[model samples]
Target: MTTLPTRTDKKLGLVIDLDICVGCHACVTSCKEWNTGGYSAPLTDYDPYGADPDGAWLNRVHTYEIANDHFTGTVHFPRSCLHCEDAACVTVCPTGASYKRAEDGIVLVNPDTCIGCKLCSWACPYGAREYDHDQGVMKKCTLCVDRIYNETLPEEDRTPACVRACPTGARAFGDLGDPDSTVSQSVNDRGGFDLMAEMGYKPVNKYLPPRKGTDRAPVTNVAPAPEQTGSPIEKLFAWADRALSR
Candidate 1:
């Protein structure tokens, strides 16, 4: 069994804003492309191009038509590995394959050491692991560790592929350990929250709740337009004008 580090030098993670995400799935595609050849082995597909297509994907966006007092609209929730501080996935691995980096607190599985056991998958509350049927191993999001630390690329391009490809800039990456970091500040200002704080996993990734848009209804307690007393011909013209204005 593996034990988590007492502490990490840096808590690097992603902050996702629920308000701005547009459900484009660009992050999902980019993650698949980069990790397939960069850090992990080629992602496998089963019966793809057939009636029953199935494949492994590290990232996915779920669309929800949520309704509440504040807002009611389509919300796109992008989910992946949260890389928790008290990662049950790591501790549950019997082969010592699952580990968390002490330098950055990034949880990862050693493909060589893994025994194709589903303990890590069962332990993860977020359902972030994917089983590669062809390779007989489990796969998951690595936070693009290879790209983040790559010195060959431009400094600005060192972020994860998901962060780079996000069209709406809903995803952000930074050292969440630092109180002064932009991610931390955004979390503070926007009321960012963990996916399941009650579980006590202490997930590093934070999600910003959707904010009420200004363009929505009830623009400062606006009253309905008053009905005007007029001739039948005048009233019809006024109604037409009001409809056109709307």
Candidate 2:
């Protein structure tokens, strides 16, 4: 079994705002595009052109219709690796292929050492790990380890691809360890919270809940009639783009 670092100097992670996300999947698309050719090259597609098309993806977005006395509406929830401080995937790896970085607290897998055991995937509670059938190895978000520290790319482009591509500026990346950092301050101001704190994995990523306001529409169980003018995909994207304007 593997072991986690007792402490990391920096805890670099993401703080996602649920209110701002529009379920656009722009982050999902950009994550796939960059990581497919990036540090984890060839994210793997099985029968892509055939009817049973499947591939490994590092990021995903899900939408939920939520309601309460405060606010009621659709909220776009993006899910990915939380990069827990006590990462079960890292500790469960038999071959030591999975490990969390001491320098910045980024959890990662060494594909060359991985034997495709899927142990790490099972250990992860967030379902962040993806098993690539073609490579026979577990994969997950790297926090764009290759890009964040790279000197060649413009300083502005060095963050994770998901953070860079979010159309609504819903996602932010920075050191959560530093109290003075902007990310930390945002957490303080917005009441950002852990995903599953009771589980005790001490996840690094935080989520800001949808804000409560009188401007929000009343909760409704009925689905809206579809707009007949455009394709379903077009309508969805169009809706996602417009959702935040309210």
Candidate 3:
């Protein structure tokens, strides 16, 4: 019998459409739930239902309001690990735990080799790496490697939980190396852009452009023109001028 090809040797990535995102934070919450439950370690919260709260979250959505003469808009930016092509996080790992896969190009952490050094977190500018205090190591988005290959899970549910939980359907997951993938097609069609592209991290994630000129409503509340008014002083001046002319 001949061996069939498996879904491997492909670099997967995400394309987030900010224009249609409703800012519900479903992706953020869902990610927390999945990682905290199934991963090697769960995200820890310092305080729950207390005066102040702190915890680890792989993803966060930021809201921005941009106003200008030519355009006005509201942007919902869902931020997470960029999984850069030139990932500094991979190079700084002394234990060789943080490494990139040459086959699929996904950055991952091998917990067994990690020594709990904090250098990798500092090397990443996007703040993607999270310290796993319980495991005595660092953790981050594995790009849902286990779920994507799990035969028990339905074929339709093979992607990251965040992508699945997105109510607005703003998140896309697929092979970035394949030029024909849906993510690549969308990026070409809609003109997707990278965040902090100048840094040359070459993030695997892409962002859809914000809707143009949709921030504020039209200028309907403009001040009404001054009502037809002739003050007493104006009328007196006019009368005096008329009399002097006569």
Candidate 4:
């Protein structure tokens, strides 16, 4: 089994805001696009155009209809590797293929050393691991390690592809170990929480809970436009006028 680092200086991870994710799937698509050609290349799609299609993806978004006595709404959850402090995936690897970086706390699989055992995938609690059928190896989100630390890219564009592609700015990446970091402070102020904390994996990534109704005005509260009051030809002219104003 692989041994994990006793400590990591930087807990680099994501802060996902469930409140405004919008289920756009932008992050998922961008992640697949970037990684499929980068560090974890050739993310194969089996029978892509056939009846029974399957593929490997690093990130995925799920939509859930959350309901209870006090709250009711749809939640868009974007899930990927949480980069846990006590990563079961890393510890379970018979080869040293699975390992966590001591410098950044980012868990990764070395494809060259991996033997496609799938033990790491089975050990992960969050279901973040992906099995590359073509390569016969376990694959997962590297937090765009190739991009994040690449000095070639502009400083502002050095975040994970998912974070960069989020249309609503729902995903964030930073050093969670530093209390003063923007990501850490956002988590602290917004009551961010870990997924399945009882599992004891101690995930580095945090999720900001969906805000309650009282916290903001409900979408249903917005009044619809009043019915247009005018003759048929006048209404046509009015509609054209409105369209032209833009």
Candidate 5:
């Protein structure tokens, strides 16, 4: 039997490719499905068809319109628990259920150890953690730790369902510690930026910025027609040109 190496040191995390994301909500839906069935308590929806349906979700996608004087467009910002390097959620947990993995650097809540106190949610700025009312525990993204290391699953299918389900291929899962990894290279080459950088969360995930058109395409005015000094037919053509220009 092949043994899996323990993720010693900070394996780092992800580099979400915002450029490729199409805001399809595949990741969101897939995450809900996986977490709902895999964990002790799957996601639950309250009044799903009622006046105000609400449910617990560890991940969400937000859409925003950003524009300057000359350009206008929409940016789809996917939000989830960043799994911060200095996660306050871990410290705030009185029962020690919320902990960060020293091996891979993933922040997780052990349902067995959790005491149902939502202090971890209070400490989170991104609102990534969700309270599981059924199990009286806190739930958040595990980065598919159980699936990734499962020997029964195929190697290619070991990643989180969100990463696998993303139709646009916006999400990536790998060791950010490896400088040469695709995630790290994308961050370095495209200049990835963090959301709410002032918070100093030091999120393991890096968000790639949206792209824009080049500045080389310039707009110019057409020259006016010369004074007409020919037959009425020729003069009419010049007048039409001037009118079209105006």
Candidate 6:
């Protein structure tokens, strides 16, 4: 069994806004492109073009439709490793290949030491872990550990690839340990919440809930004109002429 650090000086994580995510999958594609040749190289795809294709991905987007008498809309959820403060995935690893960093609290798997055990994936509640059949090892999102602190990259480009790629500005990354950080302030203002808090993983990543649509004025319903104005055939032809002129 592995042990986690009692405390860390910094807790670097993501803050995702559910209201802004458009389900574009840009973050997903960019993450795959950067990480395939990055820290966890070659996020292998088995028969990607075939009828049944699967691959290891660090980030994924899920869309769900919500409907009721009063409200109906789509929710785009982007999920990845939360880098929990009390990570069960690390504790359950028998090979000690999975560990959380004491410096920044980023959970990582040492592929060289991993023995292709699936325990880490089972232990993770978020289903963030992915097993690479070719490498015979479990892999997951490392918060782009290789990019964040690299001096070679420009200062503006030091954040995670997903954060950089999100066009709607739905994703944000920063040190959660600092109360004064912009990400923390956004979480505070928006009442950002963790997923499955009941499981007690204490995930560092926060999600800003979708804003209520009630504040916006309701759409006015326009009724069609009565057939008494003209015969049905004549009305149809008139509508077509008006549409073409417009």
All candidates' TM-scores? 0.88, 0.86, 0.80, 0.87, 0.80, 0.87
Tens digits of per-residue lDDT for model 1, 1-246: 389999999999999999999999999999999988877677888998999998888999999998898778889999999989999999999988889999999998888878888889999999999988887888899999999999999998899999999999999999999999999999999999999899999999999999876555465766998776778998799899999999
lDDT of 2 by residue, 184-243 (tens): 999999999998798899999999989986556687689899757778898898899899
Error of 6 at 244 (Å): 17
* Cand. 6 Cα-lDDT: 0.93
After superposition, candidate 3 runs with Cα above 4 Å error? 1-8, 68-70, 214-246
Worst 10 residues of 4 by lDDT: 213-222
lDDT of each: 0.91, 0.92, 0.80, 0.93, 0.79, 0.93
Sorted on lDDT, best first, the list reads: 4, 6, 2, 1, 3, 5
Clashes of 4: 0
Looking at model 2, residue 146 earns an lDDT score of 93
Candidate 4, after superposition: displacement of residue 171 in Å? 0.2
Tens digits of per-residue lDDT for model 3, 1-94: 0111223377678899988888899988988888877554567766767999777778888899877764466778888887778787887777
Candidate 2: pairs in clash: none
Candidate number that wins on TM-score, 2 or 5: 2
Instruction: Please report, as a residue range, the 10-residue window in candidate 1 with the lowest summed lDDT.
Output: 213-222
lDDT tens string, model 4, 1-246? Answer: 378899999999999999889999999999999999988787888998999989999999999999876458999999999999999999989998999999999999988889999998889989999999899998899999999999999998899999999999999999999999999999999999999999999999999988886668655666898876678998899889999997
Off by over 4 Å in 1: 214-246
